[model samples]
Target chain A: MNAAYVNVSTPHADRNISGIRLAHNRLKVAVFVFLLAFLVTAARTVELGVRSGAVEQSLALDIVVEPVQYGRADILDRNGEILATSLPSTLLQADRFKVQDPVVAARQLVEILPHLSYEKIHSQLVGKKGYVELARQLTPNQKWAINALGNPAFEFLEDEERIYPHGRLASHVLGFVDVDGKGRRGIEGFLDYRLSQTDQTQDAIRLSLDIRVQYALTYELRAAMNAFQAKGAAGLVMDVNTGEVLAMVSLPDFDPAEIKSTVEGARFNRAAQGVYELGSTFKTFTLANALDQGTIDLTDSFDATKPLRVGRFSIRDDHPKNRILTVPEIYTYSSNIGSAQIALEIGKERQQEFLGSLGLLERPSIELTAVGVPQLPPTWGKAATMTVAYGHGIAVSPLQLSTGIAAMVNGGRLVPATLIHNSEGWQEGKRVIKPSTSRKIRQLMRMVVTKGTGRYANAVGYRVGGKTGTANISVVGGYDRKAKISSFVGVFPMDDPQYVVFALLDQPKGTKKTFGFSGGGWVAAPVVKSVIARTAPLLGVAPKKEDASLYETVSLMIEE
Target chain B: MRRMVTGLAVITAMASGAAVLQLKLAVQDKTDNVRKIVQDIQVDERAIRLLEAELAYQTSPNRLQEQSNRFLALMAPKASQVLADPSSIPERPAGARVDSSIDLTVALEPEVKKPTKKRLYKRKGAQL
Candidate 1:
């Protein structure tokens, strides 16, 4: 068959050979392409395998890393104590169409969560609506227990609930959030935007408040308030140099956890919001203002032998000293006559400017939304000047008084009162008064505590110096002598003032222990003394023996 | 040589296909593991937050004060009790020794003697 085919196809051999060669070339090309594709795939596989180890390790690590959603950043104290936080909660919802037995499910739910009323659950379950909320703020354990019931209709929506673990502690500062997680009051209201901003990496908001110090202040203030039978009370502790409010308490404070239980009166932040003629505490500012302006020297004398007559009003001291009182004597005796005379010496324009520079003639610039504007006199006449010098005509918040006093003692620098912790050390405040003036004021304040009306506020070794202000509450057309605002503004370690503690009792009644006197020395000074003694050590203010030179600088020799 | 090359190519193709399949399975397993671990971590984080809140609530100052008043009869420290300087603290009495170890069983024992129960009696002066 081969010989016959060869003989017949000799002429076509060339064409057959050419076709065969073409087919062979095509096969070679196909083999080459197949080999090339396989090699490329193999190389890719090897490369992927080599990188897979890193990818595997990352995958394993990813399992342990989970994003934490706080919803709102936590509010923490200076010591990192959690003041306010958010906890994960589940809101249980049910589809009415899918529920097998509404009555049974409701009964079961009420059994698991006794806080939810059976009636409310039943109504929600059997409602005509397609979907209904069964319960909210359910814990993980509760969610699991409910899920075990195998009800497809039931669904859980993950949510967070803001919780204040400290209850009423620092409630006025930390404030409370509304149902929709909107900040409503205090720091919550002031820095709500920053707190609610969606940045999980952001750290908790650290406030200047120290819980330990707050506890001490609150305990003492409450005790004093109860003992005096006062209508309300407020207290604040602030860093003199940094202007950081360590502790601020305004009673009758309400629990932030239960917003509905809070009364309207209880919600008032007395320290920063309530404006009052803070009585004798104003005398410190008056004396400091005079000293700062160099209008009055420490040896300057004023006759307090008789009540000073100014138009229809007569400015008199509660504890009358029928003699010529020097500048130190006036401060120590809390002589209204002396303070008024000093105010006259300073003049109206200078007094207003001085007070304005100290941030007392305007609204206190704090982080709280609830701040009171100073109720200045309609006209700055002689009577208004005299009355304001004794802390009666002009009304300012306790925060302003503390801030002004802080400026006077803290080397005459006007440090703005701040609720946020200043992590960048002591802020450089604008110079409000001369350093020498501040030093003289400190000496005078120390003398007041050592020998005058503020003696009760003297803490041993702490060298507490302060002034007492007990002003009659102004009523329509007249002042009610019985209802007085007793307050004390105290600075401790007077040689170098670090903190200012201001405490006040509104409409405090006289008690037997107080010798039937609702004066600041009797009612408020003791609170300041107690707070200082307790918190000074905690604040790390080392106590030293009173230096003889320091006493001599502020001491005044009274003539008979 | 051609036959040998074909044989080698087939083996290489088979091995590479198996390796790719194995790698795909391993990747799937790792991904599932990572996903599971992430879920677990989330659960744990939630639990930790809840615990922290509960702990804070339990240890709140007000509640502690109330408990101390009721159980321990503890009172707040007075200003006089707070000495300004540690050096001002009076020296301990002679022969007094510091004991570091706290015996809970002994410490837990009541400090005060329990009051005796009063006997019930009928009084002729008092009318029921």
Candidate 2:
């Protein structure tokens, strides 16, 4: 019956019968072969799919890898100076296995990269790590030289390199990055997560630091440090208007580019980390605190005939007088006795509260990962109050002092210092004292700078006003008499206070101009003077040709 | 004649199927070549950029100054003879008065006289 059906074709019944038997056997074989192949393929695919989550994740990761390399962002200063940027740099790699002779390859590599270590690179190339990163950053010339070698396995990842063009200018504030390009200090450390990602590259890291002002301050301070043969130095410039840090420097500063070789001393950010017993400068705070508490008036007289005897310590000025000086005179001369009397009037509780109000008892509000806890007296008693009144017993960072001074003098408003520049009118300043009190403090500070210890800090057209502080360095074995920190804190155009500048020298050995005295007037005041003079023009604050009306009260207070 | 028609149909279908498979493979090959070419072009463009930058750097005024500083170790210029050419300063005022005391001519001081190779270069010491 099957033969007859196959033969139903008109070709030939006999031929069809033979062909049908052969076709049936071939059809069964073909069906069985296709089924077997399909089953094998399905089973193999299922096994591989179930085995590795790592493999699955890698496949997914490949899809999103472009954004990581192409989309890093920019860093701008407060006034739009390009502080940091992700510039395109070349990478150099080698085919170690293809290298016929390791010695010859290493020699050639060293010829191009003069500083490259052969042993280190050779090991990295031959290491178990699949992808070896030989040199992440390559100079344009170096890349050209490398490509000339022409090996197929030498892969270059056209990656983004973080470049700081300013070069060791604001090392402490700018901080540094690791091999993987991460910020380690200052604003870099503070805004690490923001800076590391690809999307945030378009948005800049706006810092309060003005490069022009920073250059001026650091340059002058460094020169002063060298001239005076000082052990160390630190300085800060803050906007009394917004508590913005225009410049902050702590020497010796290490280069942020090659951060690996930095010394411990160079790494310490003296402006925010090293606390000092701020000498007569504290009198500004003491007097302000007393005024704020209504404990004493500006014209009120204090007994300064002799140094005040408190336990074993005596509150005596560097230049004492046997007279009942008026409150202004006491602060102008920085008389410790008068400061103590004013502190006593305010009482320990009120004094403590006032200092605390100024934020002197806390760490400075700065964008730094590292800082020092202000060493406050355990018991804020009568002696503690008296000592603190003159800036002796307690210790605080330069940054804290700068901000505190700004708060006291800038219309009594305390604007917390930030590394990031705030938009116009964005800072809602906290008013710590009355405007009148602030004006009064400004006048008093001006008096100190013009007629008192900070005589050297007077910048002619700038109408500079400030106070000088020479604190004895507190050491483990009593206080280091030889080692003293001389510092000057200044405010320009005190009539309408705009900036607070602080200059300090660590263990300054007196210079020829100083006439062999390392006091604040000799060492630190001149630094402030030179810095303010240089920075004023760069900061867009032209030499004060016309005195603004806002400084009328301050001018009136100090004119006499 | 019927068997011949059946054989012709099978051969035509197989040939057409093979041609489709080959077209797909050819398209895939073209795409891969294009991708490789793109990557190569990127590498070449980067190389070109690096070379351009290097050329600019080698001829930079700063580089000239550095080279001058290096070679001048052998023959130091006289202090009084040094004069900073006012024209060299880009944004400086036309009547810019430079104090005579400044040793600006200690290094490369291109003069008003141009297009001459009267090389006033300081000879360098023995190579390190």
Candidate 3:
């Protein structure tokens, strides 16, 4: 060992010796630092974990678990008929990670759910980070099929699902929810959060729609539309006192159950989204305004011998048995000249205010999102007043017009329309006109039905009173005389004025019986009359001859 | 033996204390969870109320009966069946009029005599 190779004076040894020492020193330092870091880490770990036992203890006490509860709510109609409600439901989910051959599992799932996309399901199971996979909503049979798999991965989230037993009936009104369970439209849209929410547990949504009345309205409207060869139609009935919308329909309405489908013209809610000149129906407001404003008395006579002329336009009546007409006679005859005269007397400002007060000057808002903006007279001048008096210069959503009419003849009290069955809450009061004005309007409307354009709408013992309107379509260029918008607004039990029913036809073709005339009286009146006859009983309004005087007023007026 | 017994007792006490702490934490977590649940339930209830109201609003009958001649299958009540309260039906006077006077003779007068004369003379340059 003493005689080992020694480089006492070699340049390589002299220079390389320091390098070796330095390298060795660095290596030693590295080892010391490593040991020091390891010891410190171990100490801290002991201090915080094993010795203190703090984290472990804290983990055991974390609290954030969901609890289950029971009980639900009740639904009823305006007359207390249940429209939609909730019952118990079972939701199925699969733990994909626990599943053996996801492909095989998917195939089995397909056997149970024919609607399921087997490939899509297989892909999800094969490539998923989450443990569970939602197979599909299960019926009892589908649940059984999954149970046959006997996989522990399968689990059910006990829940409740909203159900509308009446399929396709008032579907648009009731609306629907998504698979994740969210309401999309109708009453469901209005009360989405409330119905979807859980207290300690379950809840329900109640509506004020009577399915019976809805069916009646839809059925009769469909018939009339078919009979009249109408391109499109809309109808509605409202409860006057409460402003409760009783029946509403738009031809080509969509089914709420299949809310995704764009079938025919069903997507449009005609009653709320469509606007048109309601022809002679405007006469109802004209007569009422005249009476309410003290512009004309019921006995006042108007010389309707010649068409009234105003600024390059001449007013014309649909039925041309021209003669001098009394105030009541003008109403019973549906004399446009008389209505225009009355509007002139009422003054432009008063007329504008009356229409504005009726909610006809703006887009309608009654909880639902579907609505149409009204086309009103920009300048409330004499011409606008005269024209608007007959529902020509202005157009409004059917709902706005219905609510307006409801407030008008129903004693001038405007009630906010509601679909929800109010659960004993504060009621709203908005008075639009005097009660005597409403009564006179009712009498005039009765006169119109008994002898004038609305005669077709007379419903026997229902004492139906109404007015008809026929207007030349005002198109982009000007007015299309060939295309007519015929409409009728009517009141049932005219002796007392219970409900206001309004119907309109968009470009109805003239029938042989109409003498090839597409006027409101010939085209839209029969529809209104039939509806009154049918829906009067279902609405719990027993028809009776309550007012012999009502008939007498119209009868005497017509005879003169 | 006594020392061994005492050590065993201390270990047992410590383990029991750990369990007690775990249980306390669980209870606290449960309370917080319950409070959160109540909040969620309140939200859900609100949604339910909205849905209830919205459904009715969308399905309201007056909404259906709004349009002119809106057809319905309902029959006019028989004379013996009129309701005692006729005011129950909603009516609006603002935009409605019962008497609308139109002189049909005026619109027809312009066309009635002109169409026949125009048809009677179809000559190449028929002057007045």
Q: Each candidate's chain A: what TM-score?
A: 0.91, 0.83, 0.78
Off by over 4 Å in 3: A1-74, A90-103, A122-135, A150-160, A200-205, A422-428, A513-517, A551-554, B1-128
Distance from true location, Cα of B57 in model 1, Å: 3.2
Top candidate (TM-score): 1
Query: Between which residue pairs do clashes occur in model 1?
Result: A280-A469
Report the TM-score of the second chain of model 3 against its true counterpart: 0.49
The iRMS of the candidates, in order, is 3.2, 11.4, 8.7
Estimate, for each residue in A315-382, the C-alpha lDDT of model 3 and write its tens digit: 87666557877888777777778778889999888887877787787776776757778887778778
State the lDDT of candidate 2 residue by residue for A29-94, as single tens digits: 997897698578658757766788777556441221122233334556687766666657677666
Model 2 scores what on Cα lDDT?
Answer: 0.76
lDDT score for residue A165 of model 1? 90
lDDT of 1 by residue, A1-560 (tens): 44655566665886776787899999999989987997898797578668766665654533446477777988888988889998867898898899889889988888889889999888888778999987878877898899998889999998778899988999999889997889988999999999999884247899999987898889889989999899899999999999999999999999887888888799999999999998877887788888877888887888899999988877788889899988888888888999999999999988888888888888878999899999998898988988888888889998988988999899989899999898886877999888988888888888878888888998787889998988889899989978899999999889889999999999898888878988999999999998887778788776667886877755735432
Model 3: per-residue Cα lDDT at residue A70: 33
DockQ of each: 0.31, 0.05, 0.12
lDDT of 1 by residue, B1-128 (tens): 99999898789779878987997899789788878878888888878877888888887777776665444534444445566577877899998976768667798786774433321111211110
